[model samples]
Target: MKKNLLIIPSIIFTFVLLTFFYLLVIERNPSELPSNLLNKDIPIFEAENLIKNKKFISTNEFGNEIILVNFFATWCKPCRDEHSYIKQFNNNGIRVIGINYKDDPKKTIQWLEKLGNPYSDIPIDKHGRIAIDWGVYGIPETFLVNSKGIIKFRHVGPMSKKVFKKINLLIKEIK
Candidate 1:
C-alpha cells in the first residue's frame, strides 16, 4: 500500500510539471483578456463630437468602410504610447474614431494637437457610458471593424510593435 501511494504522488507531480511546461511553450499572452464582443456587431452609440458641432451617429458613420475604434484618454500613458500605431492605421486610409473616455475635452484636444490627430471623429464619452456599452475595461483598447460594422478583433492594453504588425496583417486580411 505504501509503494502504491508513493507511485500515485509521483505520477501526479509529473503530470503537473508537464502541464506547466506545456503552458510555458505555448505562444500566448497570459496578460491578454479575451474580448467577449468579438465577431459581433458593434454596440449602437451616439455621442457629441469633440470637434464637430453635431452628434456622432453610429448608423451613419459606420458600415460603409473599415473602421478602427479606439478607447483612449489623455491621462492614460498607454494611450499616448499607442498613438503612433493608431496614426499609422489612419494614414493607411482606415477611418479611425476615438472615443474620449471620461476625459476633459480641452485637454484631449490639446493632447491630440500635440501628438497629431489620427482620428477622423472624436466622440466625447464624458461619463464613460459609451465605453461601458462597448464592453471596454481598459484605456487604449482598440477594435477592428469590417465594412459591415462587425467587430473582428479587440486588443486590450497598450499596443506593442508586435501587436501593430499583427493588426496591420488583420487589416489586409479584411475586405
Candidate 2:
C-alpha cells in the first residue's frame, strides 16, 4: 500500500512537470496571426449594424474605398486603446467598419459612446462566426482591405504610431 501511494504521487508529479513544459515550450503563441490569407479576397460577411440596429452592412457595401475591418469587443481593453487610431484612419479617408465580437448590444453601445464611435458602420457579431471566418483568434485585430476588396495587411494588436505609419504606407501602395 505504501509503495502504491508513492508511485501515484510520482506519476502526478511527472504529469504536472510535463504539462508545464508543454505549455511553456511546445504550445504555439496565441498572438501570431496567420499570413496565408494576406492579399486574398476579404471574406463575405453581412451583419446588423450595431449603431442603427435596423440596417445590415456587408463587404460589398463599402464600394471602392479602402476598408479597415476591425474585430473588437466592448470588454477588450486593447480594442479601446486602438480606437483613436481607427478614428485617425477614418479622418484620413479610410472606411472603418467595426465588428463587435460576441458582446451584448447595450454594453457595446455604451463602450462606443465612451470611446467615441469612429466606425463608419458598426456591425454586431453576437455569435462571433464572422470573426471566425476571418481567422480571428483574439480581439482588436484590424484588417486592411484594398479598393478591390483584397486584404492587404492585418494588424494583430493595438495599433501604435509606428504601425499606423506602416499601415498608411501600405494603404497608399495598395491604392
Candidate 3:
C-alpha cells in the first residue's frame, strides 16, 4: 500500500512537471493579456481635459471614428518609451485619445511639450477611476476602438516596432 501511494504521488508530480514544460514551450504573446472589455463598448467616462479647458466625454469622442485609447502616465518609463509609437499613429492619421493615468497635469503638459503631443484629446484620469473602468492592467495600455465605439483589441506594455506594424495592420483591417 505504501509503495502504491508513492507511485501515485510520483505520477502526479510528473504530470504537473510535463504540463509546466508544455506551457513554457507553447506560443503565446505576453502582451496579449485578456480583457473582458474586448468586443464590448468602451466604458462611459468624463474627465477634465488636460489641454482644453473643457470636459472630455467618452460618448462624444469614440463613436465618430476609429480611435486609439491609450492609458499613460508621465512617471512611467514604459509610457515614455511608447510615446514615439503613439506619435507614429497620429502621423498616419489615427486619432488618439490619451488618458492621463494618476499623473500631475502640469507634469503631463510639460512631458507633452517635450515629447510632441500625439493625442487629439488628453483626458485626465486623476484618481485612476477611468483606468479601472477600462480594466487597465498598467500604464502604457492601449485599446483599439472601432468607429462604432466597440473595443476591438488591447495591448499592454511598451510598444515596439513589431507591435506598431501589427496595430497598423489591424487599423487597416478595422477600416
TM-score for predicted model 3 compared with the true structure: 0.86
lDDT of 1: 0.92
Worst 10 residues of 2 by lDDT: 54-63
Write the residue-wise lDDT of candidate 1 on 1-175 in tens digits.
Answer: 9999899989999999999999999988887878888999899989999989999999898888999999999999999999999999899888899999999999998999999999999899999999988888888899999999999999999888998898889989997
Superposition TM-score, candidate 2 onto the true structure: 0.78
| Global CA lDDT computed for model 3 | 0.92
Q: Which residue pairs in model 2 clash with each other?
A: none
lDDT of 2 by residue, 1-175 (tens): 9999899989999999998888888756555757567988887778888777566646556558788989988789898888899899988978888888899989888887887888878878889899888888778899988888888888787888988999999988878
**TM-scores for all candidates?**
0.89, 0.78, 0.86
lDDT of 1 at 175: 72
lDDT of 2: 0.83
Better of 2 and 3 by lDDT: 3
Ranking by TM-score: 1, 3, 2
Candidate 1, residue 168: CA error in Å?
0.9
List residue ranges in candidate 3 displaced over 4 A. Answer: 1-22, 29-32
